[model samples]
Target: IDMLHWMSRAALEMIGRSGLGYSFDSLDEGGKPHPYSVAIKQYLPTVSEFHFCREYVLPKLRQFLPPRVCRLALDFIPYKKLHKLRDVVDVMHQTSIEIFEAKKKAFEEGDRAVRAQLEEGKDIMSILIKANSEAAEGDRLSDEEVIAQVPFRTFTFAGTDTTSNALSRILLLLSTRPKVQDRLRAEIAEAISTYGEDMTYDELVSLPFLDAVCRETLRLYPPASLSSRVARRDVSVPLSTPIKGIDGRKMDSILVPEGTKVYVSILNANRDSTLWGPDSYEWKPERWLSPPPQVLTDARIPGVYSNLMTFFGGGRACIGFKFSQLEMKVVLSTLISQFRFSLSKEIEWKMTGVATPWVKGSSVPKLPLTVELLEAV
Candidate 1:
């Protein structure tokens, strides 16, 4: 199987059911894929291609040209990527509109039906719709605002390709690292011996080794290697370690101009020797088993998930990080328990925003693994 594609479909269905209160039915091999799923798988790569400009260049354009004019100019240009991105956004907008209308009709069906919908799962759209319906007149979100939460677009994409690639990287690691693979599988098997054939939510969360492996994987191979933020106003940022200025004087702070675009180097920060020790670049899941050094612990980095910027920091941090972790753990445990994986060939990863595995000659994402089904543990 094309594991990257398979992982993408799985993530699409996951975000669909949990965030949109809808089902793409992607895993059903016989059913045709939902259009929204198709759009998302294509949309992400397009966004990544725009990153060359998104950080330093796009903000400059925004200063001179209004967003509307810029978009119109882009439409006029004969760039295939820009046009494809626009079409994808249109598809997402239309889908969100349809989903919003259906949920609104459900609300009109009476309180009981709405409650049933909520009970199915607190899918983001349902919660947003419900909150809007019950809020004071001044507090209610507009229909458009609520619809923007629809899956296969907006925040829900965090759980899609970004997550799929992260999981694939972990899988590739397990296939390549035999000792780590055996230890992880043993941990998974031992934990679920008394529970049943499958690992439960409680068991999945409590397994220490499993948690460490996931965390270490995330730290070493972050799904989003870089993030962009444009300054809204001139501000000074403090540094933990001061740098010397051009005049040969120590500089405690640096001024950032308004509208300046800054790219946060997530991968570099995660692998920094100052924080994670000199061996940080190496993939060693066992590092989590011990306490981190004091110098590392004392310097508090404010990232949302753990101390790493794998999911970023602040208000705009990934909303579905815990959800993604749950999916990864469950998928890893399930897959490893039933099969043995061995690397079939060299797999090169390409960072099109979310890093994905690619072979030298193939455009498609492919990571070949020799798989053998194992008898029940």
Candidate 2:
């Protein structure tokens, strides 16, 4: 829990400093619970309630209740009950706007001198804001619109938990495999020793074994399980291999009408033996080191990650792929070098169909682990 929380805080701070010239001070000050965090926490439950109404209550109510009746029902609903929801959302939006306004004010008052000094003078947000200001009116995002997206600017949730969970899982697997862990540790040590004080981006990217381990972990247990897409036009997707239909007849293709919802199962595809060979189910980084079989690399399988779709594929693939990889490597290196992690207790991680898997009990649950500090040579 501590590691995950810290990682989350660090990632958010990093994103803020890199993506924007603002620092949330999440890391340096122990991320002391601020209004923003409180607002976020309160807003989520309210939003969940609103969505629940739309998905469950509203739909069922519409079946029998007339629009006028529904309106009357809402009128009777306690204002106090709804006020909590509205207050939180309002605070969140207001805080975002306030922050954006502050940035703009800083820029106009002193040419962003204040922000430049604080952010080391090279934030992506500043660049974007400048570009947006210089661009044609139609092509640029307004200051208000840009500020409105402040809540989404740092990807606070994703930046924090996803990489940490992935690293935790990898460490757990390594704990079980002593030989593999030792080998990897040795590789890391050798690389560091050879490269001198700091590891460069090129050196990190060139670490084939580390890359393979990260890839393998992502393959076996992708943080994200399912991705959704809607068909733009009527299309027929032919199966690479025939499947026996309910009528016991071989079917080659599935007809998808326009506007049809399609879900691509990334987890299942990652483990498909036909695409990944007999040992597809196993967590073996060696497979990544060697060339995948011709069949697996064929165009039939479209995956941005190891021809297995961990990050999805093509134009719709994750824009943050490189950023995510670098973040993971840096965090993994830092943790592994500093400490040795082991499973604290034997517990099964429950799966969810969301972008990332979570434990069964709560929305943001912790993975328990015991750790020991490594001695400096």
Candidate number with greatest TM-score: 1
**Cα-based lDDT for every prediction:** 0.81, 0.68
Model 1 C-alpha lDDT per residue in residues 52-84, reported as the tens digit of each score: 787568889999999889878877889888899
TM-score of every candidate relative to the true structure: 0.89, 0.80
Q: Give each prediction's root-mean-square deviation over alpha carbons.
A: 2.8, 4.9
State the TM-score for model 1: 0.89
What is the lDDT, from 0 to 100, of the residue 181 in candidate 1? 86
* C-alpha-based local distance difference test score of model 2: 0.68
Q: Candidate 1 has which clashing residue pairs, if any?
A: none
Deviation from native of the Cα of residue 184 in model 2, angstroms:
2.0
Candidate 2 per-residue lDDT, tens place, 1-377, comes to 34444554555566666655667665654447445555543444355457557656887989998977976665467877576765675675676677667776776677557646534556655665666657897898977667644334345433444565576677768767767776777778888889954899999778888888899999988867777687999999999888999999999999999988799998999898887889989999888888878887684678766676777887778656667778888777767766777655553554432222233464554555667888998
Off by over 4 Å in 1: 30-32, 51-77, 109-115, 150-152, 197-200
